[model samples]
Target: MNNKPLAERIRPEKLEDVFGQEHILGRGRILNRILKSGRITNMIFYGPPGVGKTTVANIIANMTNKRFYKLNATNASVKDVKNIIDELDTLFSVDGVLLYLDEIQNFNKKQQQSLLEFIETGKITLIASTTENPYHYIYKAILSRSTIFEFKLLNKSNIIDGLKRAIKIVESELKDKNIKIDEEALEYIANVSNGDLRKALNALEIAIFSTNLDERGIIHIDLNTAYDCTQKKILNFDKFGDNYYDILSAFQKSIRGSDPDAAIHYLARLIKAGDLISICRRLLVTASEDIGLAYPNAISIVKACVDTALQVGLPEARIPLAEATLLLSTAPKSNSVIKAIDAALYDIETKDIGDIPAYLKDAHYFGASKLGRGIGYKYPHDYDNNYIKQQYLPDNIKDVKYYIPGKNKLEEKIKSYINRLKGSEL
Candidate 1:
């Protein structure tokens, strides 16, 4: 039996053997065009784990005829990098070097900067792979020198295709024994992998290796055996990673888009990831920012739900979270509140204004009639409807209109009432 792990045992040797990421590696794609031109530039491969970042880097080295050297940034240091740099002057360096740095995000600024000169001068073709966003974690100099390709999560179909390849490799290894994997079992592994090919392959290996052969002299792997190998479905969420932010973004957008299904779907994902705090905070923001004014009561309802969720944490907390998500998603949507506040803030930040109107200025001081304070101020209660058209803004920007009521029923009613008051009393 080969001691190497199944992922390594069946690592794709060629671009055609690689699974997923067709966007980059497919025909006529940018990376594909680069490889076909017989020249590999300095590049950054970024995405989640168990995709084809490292595998494609290896394929590039093999196709380009460049000397391939890999170092994981987690443990590699400046000395290790110097070792590779020293080779650039040797006879073996005639072919050039392709340095594959895995998890390049872990490398500090100085360590990444050490390779700037070599990569800039074409002494080494660097293929830096990171699961984190390269633009955020990688040094700016290194990013400026490389093209970034994002490797997205593999879908279930792509994962199943990879699993089929693994099954063939496993069956070929056991020539004396036949391996029969049920179709349902194959898909079970694919579904539980959460778009990670290597994770699915490992689970499949576990099911095959750990199961006992039936009386038919064949290793029969069923759904039950697959379940045993995969105890829980993979949840691809890092509380501090890009996935967390992406999910939160999608959740809020879904609610704003009035798609309860998508909103609840992302809500469930957040809940499964144990991100109750993010969910609560985002829900409250959505109520005010997205559902404000249209459903003026939504803020109160969502606040109550959030309080309930906090009091009763998950798995029970998902109930009130779901309620809040669905309520905000299905409620009448309006961004008037956020827009109004933001417009006011923009003026405060960028524009100049004159003094406050005397009628609106503080009149409660010791001064009786000094400083033109509270002069000609008509108390609203003294008016017929307890409302009078008055300028509350500074003199310069008093005519600037910031709050444009949304075209919702509540805002429309408020707009009509204000217009009536302006016509009757202005």
Candidate 2:
């Protein structure tokens, strides 16, 4: 009778047993090469939860003879770190130490800097994991010293494979060949996991134990059982469900359509469903895509609101999310930003753009002047009004218009300023 949760009871012990993350774990990959060399460097793993960050770290520790120490940055402090450092002279630590720090983003600047000396001297091999962007949350000095690897969310097939393995393990534990599962039920659990294999395993375990055995002495699982175990009634994970993406779509469309009432209506529906991540992401995108230069400051406001929503979370998060929705709905709309970027991308893919101007090429290198690089460059600030007309585009596409100002107040003023500078209307 194992008391541990199914996720931990059946955790992958080797890289071959680990699912997904093949980009880093696949044959002949950089991580594989490093592991083969038997020298693990300072590294950072960045990804969402349940994507095998901890599992990979465990595998690395198992492969090496080094002393392994695990600490969660959310709870562990400098004192806990000092405890490990103090043990360096002990008998078992002769092979060096591998410290797997989870949620390393939670460690503040001073706490992170404390590890600089140990990692620099190869006394401790640091494998830090973060759910957030490492470049944004980690110290730059630490980033320069470590290689960062991104873990992607598990696709449906990857999750299904894991679920199948879990079922086999459960059958072996229960010593029963009578456990039966519907294919649809299995997929339902996988779909509702939302790229998280741990969630699917937990849901499957609940569905198996909660259901009563029939007169035939066989346990059966169906869609209803999975739905109940997953609690999808409140947090709809089905992308096609009315309670899921439809509401999210309407929420963004309402904002883009400038209907504050409709936008608020959809926002309330999303908040009720407890989909704060979706609401925050869509709000941030709408603020930039729909609002644009019409109200250039809307992006910063929406960003602050999204940050506040994420920090506070749930019922309290609804306040800032609602504010962002209302602001984007009522704010003037513009598709100019998307249009300009898409147009530029299309030309890059389709056209044969010539080389960059010699003046715009990298000129800091030795003998750049010999190749005519930076020869005719004109400094804008050296001219009147801190402006100077120059040929910025490549020779082939110099006349192509990628940016066209939208007829909004801010953009109109911008167009006027540019027109005055060029002595012509754009």
Candidate 3:
């Protein structure tokens, strides 16, 4: 008996009823294969909101004819979850419980970890959904255990199709009221909703309630009214303490996109908000990791700016700070620095992080040269230092080459120097 209207009344109840994600739900899809074969794995549906994640889970439940239960990580707790597991044991004698956990990443590590056995032992077929990227935010062990399916946001055409479905619902619900809505206005609602089908439907519901006259009466629903009705919903980007990520995102995108003006704008925002110190540190890193060698001088200049800011203090230090940002934004960009480290890290992960070659190791200690550790070591000062083919790599990594310098002025010099030093080896 709530005052909510059409969209609420007609939420889809079956898989065939769900829209979008055709690849997953289309004929003979992998997901369909999993379900029809009775081998559906523990899954995590990850993407932006309202692209049929929940509906898919429901379809899974329906296909299996299993007991279905929903828990929101926002409200459910350890005890509550345990209670639900116990309740499933008590109520359902069917194959398994199909547990749909929404916003699963919101649960802390321990809470999430609790679900592992239930998944492993086949106590439940857990389908978790999250808007945030779980790879970054969720615990690793949990992620490794589950199959992940990424869902993308619906595009314009998909949104139009979903809107058409909503229109049918609206027409059905308000049939007795003799009310009508313009297709263009409905399309505007779909556009504003931005691929969130729930958002589009919700906006349609609100617009219906807000309009005093339907198409038969006054035929009114201007772009402003359709827009204002939904856009007024809260999007408060509370610039509280934790806005560091947001600021960093803006800075990274600006520098990567080569918009020096926007980079400066984001810098000003962080600086004004008293997060200048953090901004300065990240920029110091960005100069080397992102703009390194492309503009080798950028790192030293950024370091100088950091020192200047710290030594002289803020109120007046923003001058050098601004200068460093301008140089970094306008300078040539390269990810070679970070890419080198990342590739090295990948090697460490998949292969052994081998030790330095004996030749590369220290020979200064007693009895050291006898072990061939530094027996043939070539001190650059002993000779010309211009072209010395020293064994620098660990035995394991001797033939493994990782770092590829980006095309930049300083790296070109580095390439030439390396070529001269290791002419035969290279």
| Per-model TM-score on C-alpha atoms | 0.97, 0.63, 0.64
Q: For candidate 1, lDDT tens digit of each residue in 1-426?
A: 888999998999888888988898899898889888987899999999999898898888778766789999999999999999999988888888899999999999999999999998898999999988887899999999999999999999999999888888988898888889999999999998988998998998998899888899899999999889986886878887877899999999999999999999999999888888899999999999999999989989999999999998888999999999999999998999999999999998898987888888888888845888899888999988898767889989988888888989998898988889778312
Clash tally, candidates in order? 0, 0, 0
**Compared with the true structure, what per-residue lDDT tens digits does model 2 show for residues 1-426?**
577888897899978888998898899998878877988899999987888999999989998889999999999999999999988779989988999999999999999998988988888999999977787789988999999999888989989999888888888888864578899999998887878888888998898889899889888898888888896523333443323655788889999999999999988878876778888889988888888989989999999999999999988898988888888999988888988999989999999998999999989999999999999999998999888989999999999888789988889898999899978777
lDDT of model 3 at position 62: 70
Clashing pairs in 2: none
Q: For candidate 3, report its TM-score.
A: 0.64
Clash pairs (backbone) in predicted model 3 = none
lDDT of each: 0.90, 0.87, 0.74
- Regions more than 4 Å wrong, model 3: 1-7, 88-91, 136-145, 177-184, 232-284, 297-406, 409-426
The C-alpha RMSD of each candidate to the native structure, in angstroms, is 1.6, 13.6, 7.2
Worst 10 residues of 3 by lDDT: 233-242
Candidate 1 — number of clashing residue pairs?
Answer: 0
The model with the greater lDDT, 1 or 2, is: 1
**Candidate 3 local lDDT, 1-426, one digit each (tens):** 345545445557766666777777677887767777977778999876778887777777777766778899989899877876786566563567778999997899999888777877787778999877778667787788788887766776777677667666665655655335666777787776767778877776677668787556643556666776776432212344223576678886787667889988888777666666677777888898889878888888889888888788777777888888888888888888888788888888898768876777788899988888776667776667645556677677777766776787777778887777767322
